[model samples]
Target: MEGIEGGGIGGYWWWAAASSAQLAWGINFYRKGYAGDSRFMPLKAFAVASLFVGATASAAVGILRASGVHSVEDAKEVGASIRSGLGIPRRARDE
Candidate 1:
């Protein structure tokens, strides 16, 4: 009820959505777990974990894009001179 306190609506919304999604997925997974299929548990676990990780990464990318801090390309450019300064090994002319 306190209007816009501490991170405002955007932060709270993002946190709530992410957490609810995680809880729902966890419940559904446990409820449907295999009853002796042997390979089923491992397979399902992998799939669920992959889904969670992919979703989180996508959300992070979205936030970064919104902030206009797109990629490592900019950081790489800044460090390029340092990288080059380290120098690559040269082959002997006889080869």
Candidate 2:
């Protein structure tokens, strides 16, 4: 996979901008929902917010991999860091 690293700077900017827009729209949806402006919008508001969160977190890890964390051990350390940060259960073989 190319890790969203193509198209040079423009592509990176496009991705960042798009992610920001998605998050903004999600927040707007939540605001409108809580304010009772839309009766059926609260559920979708959570979905969109989670989507943005997942996408951004995934993108950050992808970026670290693409930017030259090449060695296997380095990758493992990165993974461990991620697991720890996310409070994920560590494997028995974890370092």
TM-score of each model, paired residue for residue: 0.43, 0.42
Most TM-score-accurate candidate: 1
- Count clashes in each candidate, considering only residues at least 3 apart in sequence or on different chains: 0, 0
Residues 1-95, model 2: lDDT tens digits = 34354423433554556566766866776565554457656677668778679668656644554455646887788888899999998999865
The TM-score between candidate 1 and the true structure equals 0.43
Give the per-residue Cα lDDT of candidate 2 at 10: 34
- Deviation of model 1 at 78, angstroms: 12
lDDT of 1 by residue, 43-64 (tens): 8788777657755765664454
lDDT, residue 16, model 2: 58
Q: What is the Cα-based lDDT of residue 53 in candidate 2? A: 90
Candidate 2 residue spans exceeding 4 A from truth: 1-11, 34-43, 58-62, 69-74, 77-95
- Per lDDT, the best of the predicted structures is 2
Worst 10 residues of 2 by lDDT: 2-11
Which residue pairs does candidate 2 place in steric collision? Answer: none
Off by over 4 Å in 1: 1-27, 30-32, 73-95
